[model samples]
Target: MATVILVRHGRTAANVQGVLAGRTAGVGLDAVGREQARRTAERLSVVPLSGVVSSPLERCRQTSRILVARQEHAPGTQVDAALTECDYGTWQGRSLGDLAAEPLWSVVQTQPSAAVFPGGESLRAMQARAVAAVRRHDAAFEAQHGPGAVWAAVSHGDVIKSVLADALGMHLDLFQRLGVGPASISVVRYGPHRPDVIATNTEFGDLAWLGALGPVADAPVGGGAGHGAPRADEPAARKLAP
Candidate 1:
């Protein structure tokens, strides 16, 4: 199967304001969010993408456009409803601090599988549809562009977390353990045997090695000389910009 890059949309006013934007219309990326997307684009410009799919929200569409703009091949972009934000229903536009006081908040924090927004979708249902959508697109890209093809999916935080949890073989209830910050990138490749999680919640790093990735085989013994040794003056891993 093809490799899929899961990109969470950059920050928005709702994010800065600590409010749940949910599927509310017209919620687009703010200034910092646009800059974050641009930085993400710079990181991804080294690799060629087969396509870019985004949630049908302004934030994700804007991020997708920025990403495609920096792509070496300028992959086409499209919208996928399945990749949209979780339907927070009554929770939409509510302050996070206020929602934290609701009884359901504890359930959402402790066991998301059983958490369902009032008049909205269940967390389990969200994971199911998102996993299905990602796998479907992975298969389509693999068939159309071959196994080495790469693609991007620009979506919401919770949506991407659920997809990552599924890819990691973690249960829905444990998905909250993962943290996906604004504009963070996660990489996954579906194989015949299992899905390989190449990276998760990455904000800074050189991704040019992705262009040279081989077939999705079993993990190399002893980690197999990862991405090559760093240069003498370089740190073993990149430090997040302050």
Candidate 2:
């Protein structure tokens, strides 16, 4: 019922070094990341946010802080584990170059639904949980703030991508084709008819339009189970790469 704006956390040292980072603690944003977070915050400052939800990681929390600080009413920030980085398991802290050598790496890229990190969660599991968390929060926030209210969730790149894939109703394997740069913004509004993706991986634009509430610009009202289905002309799904 409400619009949830997904913002991937700013770049980090691990990002610069090309490490998986995973759930490793103390991975704060690098200098470039701090600036990215600030710029993203500034871009969103003109809009009114009901709240800011962040992954329970230093990077996401830091990013959330920057965004909430710039808001007029300064919406409160809360930590949600559902938005945390996908547990990379043994791959944690390993450089992507080295991970690329592993046999499972290709599976991760092409068939994530079947890929499971040794000693950690599968990509499919990550996507499922992340989507569920987002839906749960969307319902809660909509109940609290009303249909037109806007909120933000600061999360990891993969986590946000997975959420996008779910919102688009795409298979998890296709998520890699979707790129989520650090500090990018993706917008989604869950209505009675269907979930509408307003924007994705946004760099810059006027967001004041999102502050408007009640009755989305497009999409029809609800009727039944298929009410959320896209229009006949709408693509069944959006894919990035073959």
Number of the top lDDT candidate: 1
Q: What is the Cα-based TM-score of model 1?
A: 0.93
- Give per-residue lDDT, candidate 1, residue 227: 61
| Model 2 quality (TM-score) | 0.88
Worst 10 residues of 1 by lDDT: 233-242
Instruction: Record all residue pairs in model 1 with backbone atoms less than 3 Å apart, i.e. clashing.
Output: none
- Each candidate structure's TM-score, on Cα atoms with residue i matched to residue i, is 0.93, 0.88
Q: Write the per-residue lDDT of candidate 1 for residues 1-242, one digit (tens) a residue.
A: 78999999999999999999999989999999999999999999998999999999999999999999997678877899999999988999999999999999999999999999999999999888989999999999989999999999999899999999998999888999999999999999998888999999999999998876767777667776576443334454542322
lDDT of 2 at 240: 23
Local distance difference test values of all predictions, in order: 0.91, 0.86
Q: Using TM-score as the measure, which candidate wins? A: 1
Off by over 4 Å in 2: 217-242
Clashing pairs in 2: 148-213, 193-228
